[model samples]
Structures are given as structure tokens and as C-alpha cells.
Target: MERILPSGFRFTPSPAQLIGHYLARKLCDLPIASNTINDADVYACVPAELDSRFPSLDRFQDCRYFFTWRMPLAATGARVSRKVGSGGVYKGTQSAKDVVDANGRTIGYRQSFAYFDKSGKKTEWLMEEYGIRRQVVDGTKDLVICKIYLTPTARRACDRR
Candidate 1:
């Protein structure tokens, strides 16, 4: 039996939905209907290569999302790490934003980073990584969901006539 989405279907989901629902289900080993979300160490691969590997992203011209497990940075012990890909490393801009639950309690965080080339030139590729803030027994098993997309500046540059 094949399942299909209704007409005019869109996968637009809020930050809470991504972390609280999807990411939570993933960490709990629950089954998710769509196969678009895959497990990957997003920091290990360049954005372009990572984007090409996912078949579910063929329809999206703008952004691609994935579920990744990010280890804590050794220096700061923060969720955002400075791990470099084959090309370069990812540098986060500001601190992570708090993801609050319906009861006004902080549940998770959303952090954004920019990819830089080997020459130290910043690329248009950007990634938003989301992770739960709640304490867990094994930190290594924690999974963080990330959304990778081109910056608006890059999009405009590409669309220029």
C-alpha cells in the first residue's frame, strides 16, 4: 500500500515541531512516516555534497533538513562544535536561541552556523542545528536535527539576471 499526501501539501514545520515532535520521535526510536529526514554527521561533509546525497531533497530548491548527532565541543562544552568538513569549518554566529515549550519552559535550542572555505572565505551555505536542552543519561547518543540552506544573500546572487 502506498501513502500519498493530500493536494497542496507542504512540509513547513515550526521549530517546536521539528525538535519536540520529529527529533524527539527519532531519539526515542519511533517510526516516522516520511524518509526525508535521515541520520547524518552533517559537520563531516560539505553542504553541497551533503545536499546531493539525500534523494528526498530533489524537490526542494531552497533548503534541506537532516537529523545529526553533534558531539559537544571540547573547549566550550557547547552543543555547537567547530568541526571542519573536507572543504573548511563551520562557525556559528550568535548563541543558541531557546526553544520554549507550551508551558513557557525551555525545552531545546536552535543554533545557526556558516560554512567557510579553505581560503577562509565565508560561503553562502548556512545550517541551523536544533537539540534538546533537557538532561540525558548518555550524552553521546543525543541526536540534533539540522536544516541546511543557502543564505538569502546567496540566493539573490544566484538569481541575479
Candidate 2:
């Protein structure tokens, strides 16, 4: 809610930066370069509710990022739950796809989802979920980075191929 940067500033970190740097530091409880990305119960709220959580920080109107905890769903083991909020569910368009660094080293995993309303109607909202590799941290990871945005027109172009 506080303005830490100049007006009209934009913070669009790449997938590498999201997982390799910020998220990696997050797993270790380290500080990041900016407070633009916030902590939230991502799965507990519909994508539309995000605006209220961070407000319309002018420049961040189109994209919002959050650090959320992944709850273990299995009865006896580790299985990150995907149960979304009552308003809707995030239907996975792609599962844990490998995200590699520029040098071709696997840094983390990325999952893509399209938001569907309670009635099962797809919405324009989309999300990219990122989780870290053990190489970045030494233990079982529970926290994740969630980036939510409207579906880009470029996505339709990609699908054309």
C-alpha cells in the first residue's frame, strides 16, 4: 500500500528472476530488491479479489504477483493442493513444466492455469505458478510464487501454430 518507487514505475521480473532470485531468497527468508511483490493467501481468493489486496498501484494495474504457501493435500505425504477459492477454480492448462535459466540449467517449475468461474465458465484471468528447486534450497519447499494476469493476446498467436 505504501509507495516505495517513483510514480509509473514497473516491476516485471522474468520467470528466471521470479524463481531463481526472489523466490530462492524467499525460501531462505532473505529480503528482496523491492516490496512490489507481496504475500497473500493466493488460493483463498478469486483473481478479481487481488485488486483490493494491493489496490491499483497505478503501474501494476495489469499484473500482480504474490508469495503464497502451498498446502500439503495428501493424507500421509506431500501433495500441494490446488483447491481454489469459492469464487472459482484455476484449471491447469499446463502442469509442472521445467523452467530453465539462460544457461540451460533447470531452476524451477512453472504451472499455467486459466480461471474458471463456479459455473465452469472460463474467464480471461490466468495465472503462472512458480516453485523452487531443491538446488535453490535445502529442504521440502512449501512456499510458491503466483503471478496473475489477464490472458495476453500473444497467447492466441502462439496457439495458432
Candidate 3:
């Protein structure tokens, strides 16, 4: 039973809150503080359709977050095809960076991705994928929390240094 909230409601958790609280509880099979996060295969949908596909309490109604499995395409867990959801691929724009906790310990990883059109043209859509190194109860890779949104500015403006 999913509880739906108002559209204007905001769920702006910090990186630590997202990983330490929501994600950790989810993997441990514990109850979340709130039913604000949705478990979905984010790669299966396009960035533009996320809001309607997996709606949550978005801040300013401009962004969306999803909890998805970090399942790789091959058994080796090295190869993956991100090209799903309407014939486009969400290519990684940068390397995976560490998301540290208050004590400066790396608790999870974050990676940025930019969507490219079917013709290989870069779109204004952007995504930040966060994942941990721990495996789930089923012995799969860690679950991921993806923050997807359309860039408020030009694509390069959102490029992290």
C-alpha cells in the first residue's frame, strides 16, 4: 500500500540522510521513517517520464529520486547497457565519487550522468546515481538512489568540477 503525498511537498534529504537513513533501512529490511522513496528500475524509464512514472514529494516539483537495484547486465558485473527507456542512453559524465559521512568515512558512492538523445546529442537532463558497496540480502550489488532532473541551466553549467 503506497501512500501518496501532495505534489508540492518537499523531500530534500542530504546525502548522508539519503544513504545512512533511507537506503540503509531499505537494504536492512527495516521500516523507513516515511514512504517517500519509491523502488523502481530507474534505467527502464526516461528522465522526462520519471515524475509521472514514479512520483514522489519533489522539491519545487523540479526533481525526482528513485531507489533501484544496481544490477549489471553481465555476470561479470562489468558490462551494462544504460540505453533504455525510449532509445536513449544515460551516459556517465564523470567518475564515481565517494559520499562521506560526518566522520569523513566513505559510506557510499555518487556518479553523475547526462542523457544523450538517440542520435547521440546531449540533452539538458541530468542524473546523479548514489550507491553503496555492500550487497543486499539476495547477494546482489548494493541498491542505488538516483536523483534525476532537468538541468535548470545549460548542460555545462551543471558539470561538477
Candidate 4:
């Protein structure tokens, strides 16, 4: 059956829906709707440049989401590397938050990161990375789903007519 959303409606999955449905389906090799999300190595470019790279994101003016394989940092043994993008790095601001399923079982983790320039100035870019908590299959441990967006301040300013 064809699943169609209302006109002008968007697929805004909550954090739990993201992990339990979309990300889980992807990892399990299940079918997801075509073009709902695209795969990109988001760390390679600044967030501002990401929307341009993925034309599918044209519908979303304030945020864009992508699936990418994050490399584990040797220093901290974390899934996301601190150094990413051109002359910039991503800094984690808080501890990983647990994503729970309907029965309250922890299904995944979510963490936020901010982009900083070479001079250590924080930019408007923010990333929310999500990953399954289960033991991943070999060679797929670093896979993650990321949602990139402008900071609230920047988003509000940009959205203002």
C-alpha cells in the first residue's frame, strides 16, 4: 500500500521514532520509503553546505537529516570523532541521553554536538546523533543517523520573513 502524507506535511519523526523505526529499519535491512532520507558523509562539510549537497532537503529550510557512518575516535572511544569538517571540530555538550521504547527499555542513545571553527568560536550548526544500544554486527559499529540543524537563535532569525 502507498503511504501518502498530506500536502505540505513533513515526516518529522520524534527521537524515539527515529531510532526505533527509521534507524532500526535501516540497520535491519528493512525497506524505508524512497527519498525520505538520504545517506551522506555529513562530517565532510559544514552544516550550511549540507542542504545544498542534498537536494532532497530542499523541503526543509531550517533542518536537514542524514544517515552517515561516524568513525570512532581513538582517544575517547566514542562513535563521533571530535575533528570533522574543514578547519572545524564538533564538541559534545552533554552526556548521551537514553532512548527508550514503549516498555521503557533503552533502545538507543542520543547525543548533541556543536560545531566550532578553528579559532574555537561556536557556530550556528548543531548535530543530534543517534545510535542503537544493541551490540552492532561486525564492521557496522560506527554507523549512525544524524540530524543537523541551525541553533534555535539562528533558525528563528532565518525563518523570520
Candidate 5:
């Protein structure tokens, strides 16, 4: 994957996580499952209602568009164990809270994610929200996300980069 930087040089999370935990909380409404075929391939178990709830998914799924997938945000609640089943990527309950951005007057949110690996091991990652006052931008104003694969120790080992 190519890392897109601004013309002058700038950095920001793809999708802008605007609404932060609020959007993350929205993910809770959408179901996600690890592909039994491949652990790296996480599948969004989007129900039919989601088609109406989030029309963007349809547009993103369009192969004609370069953007073939939506921003994947997922977490399990108390029932996560029963949700993911076996051969899953991450498991455990996750929660997000919205917070104001201290750096600017614009409102922003952040989500704190906690979950366990397939081995019943605990893990956590902090995801900063990006979307607000803005919607979507091609490679320019959009938030960039790179999925880095970590070891059991949770140390970065490799990624799509």
C-alpha cells in the first residue's frame, strides 16, 4: 500500500474518525466476523438493514471505484465470545468515548479499544477519530489507515506498508 502525504507534507488518520466514539459506537450496531478462510481477511457481517443505515457501503463496495472497502471499525461487547466463534482475529468487549480535541476549536472524538486475541490473550489499541466539519476526500483530505500486524507480544512486526 502507498502512504499518501499532502503536497506540502501533512499527516492525518484516514476517515478522520470524526464523531470518534460515536462512530465507533455505530460500529457496534454493525456486526463483524473473522473470515474462516483467512485470519487477515476480516469480514464485515453487514446485515440488510445496514444497507439502509449506511449507504456508503454500497458505494465503497463498487469495484469500479478505487475505494473497494469501507473503513473497518469493530469491537465486541459482553457477548463477543459467542459472536466471533472460532478462528477469529480479535475477541473481547470494546468501548469508545467521545472527547474534545484540545489542539483545535473543532470538535473531535477518540475511541479506546480493548480486546483479546484468538488465544484468549488481552490486547488494546487507541484509535483517534478524524471526521467532522468534513465528509469525504479522495486521497487528499481523507484519513489514511495502515493495518500493522503485531506479534503475540503486541509489537509491530509488519504491515501492508
Candidate 6:
């Protein structure tokens, strides 16, 4: 094996961890990383195919769910964006009870997205057509929120229009 620095020489967190911290600090505005984003979350974009084939997805609506919403990134123009799919996400740990429909069929998946403004205001959107609720966790300002349900074909129509 090639010789390497001993464990004592290792930095407190390691270079990789430091880089992660630095990059996250540079990229993520929120001090707390939003649970909305993950490998699974990026893979969970609406029109599932777009999430899979990105940069080359045509007929996006064919794969099912899709949404386009904006939240404050810093000022008026900056924003964090999200596109959620209609088909359920495949997280492997999600319970059937969490995703199954009342009729015992799986409808689209439910995903929540949050983005914090530079002012430290966190705005969140829940993407799903059925049974959604909101809680005022604290005395923060509420931003404009909109929710719409789209079928695969409807999404395709919106894409062309």
C-alpha cells in the first residue's frame, strides 16, 4: 500500500469534510440545510424522466408529477426552485402508510421544500395535491404559496405552451 499520513496528522474533520463544509457554506444560504434537497430530492423532480435524463428530457409530463415554484433566495430576484414529480419517490425507507392512498393505491409522492432568505426567513412549500396542512412554527412572515395538481399529460401540455 502507498504510504499516507497517520491518523494523528489527520485534520480535525479531514480535508473532504472541510471541503464539504466550505462548499456548503458557499452554496447553501441557510445555516441549516433544508431537508427538501437530497440525492433522492433532485431525483424527485416532476416529470420523473427529467430528473433521470436531465438536459435531454422531452415529453416531461409523460412520467407523471411536476411542479415549478419559487422562493426567496436572498433578495427579490434570487430564488430557490423546485420541481416535484407525481409518481412516488423511491427512498427505500418510506413506509407504505406514508405514501399509500386511501384506496390503497399510491398516488403521487409528497415532498416539502424549504429555502431561507438572507434575512433568515425560511419559507417552505409542500408539493402534493391531497391532504396538506401548514403550521406556524414561529412568528416569521409567510410568503406567497401556491399548489397545483397536474397529470402527466397536463404537464406535457404546459411544457409545450
lDDT of each: 0.76, 0.77, 0.75, 0.76, 0.28, 0.30
Candidate 6 residue-wise lDDT, 1-161, digit = tens? 12234443322322232223422342344362322111223324433244344321123222212222233234443223332344332211222122343455442233333323234343221233211122323332222212222344545566789
Backbone Cα, N, C clashes tallied per candidate: 0, 0, 0, 0, 12, 3
Which segments of candidate 3 are over 4 A away from where they belong? 1-9, 56-61, 135-142, 154-161
lDDT of 5 by residue, 1-161 (tens): 23333344322223333244333333355432211111111223211222233322112121110111223232211121212334323332344333455454445433322334456555442222223333433322222111222232332322222
| Superior candidate under lDDT, 1 versus 5 | 1
RMSD of each: 3.4, 5.5, 5.1, 3.8, 14.0, 17.2
Model 1, 30-147: lDDT tens per residue?
Answer: 9988765667788788888886776434344567788887766443444435566776888888788999877787779998899998789998899888888755444444588888
Q: What C-alpha lDDT does candidate 2 achieve relative to the native structure?
A: 0.77
lDDT for 120 in candidate 2 is 86
Whose TM-score is higher: candidate 1's or candidate 4's? 4
Candidate 4 per-residue lDDT over residues 1-161, each given as its tens digit? 23245667676778888899899899888998755666888878777788666543334555767888876644344354657668788889898999998999898999999989878899988988988865434334366788888888886787685
Best by TM-score: 4
Q: Give candidate 1's error at residue 23 in angstroms.
A: 0.7
Q: Give residue 98's error in model 3 in angstroms.
A: 0.6
Position 106, candidate 6: lDDT:
42
Q: Would you estimate the TM-scores of all the predictions?
A: 0.81, 0.80, 0.79, 0.83, 0.29, 0.19
Clashing pairs in 4: none
Return the clash pairs for model 6, or none. Answer: 46-84, 65-85, 65-86
Model 3: how far is 61 from its true place, Å? 5.3
Order of models, best TM-score first: 4, 1, 2, 3, 5, 6
Clashes of 1: 0
Say which prediction, candidate 2 or candidate 3, comes out ahead on lDDT: 2
Clashes of 2: 0
lDDT of 1: 0.76
Instruction: Report the lDDT tens digits of candidate 3 across residue range 28-91.
Output: 9999866777777777877767756755454344577789866666655654457766788989
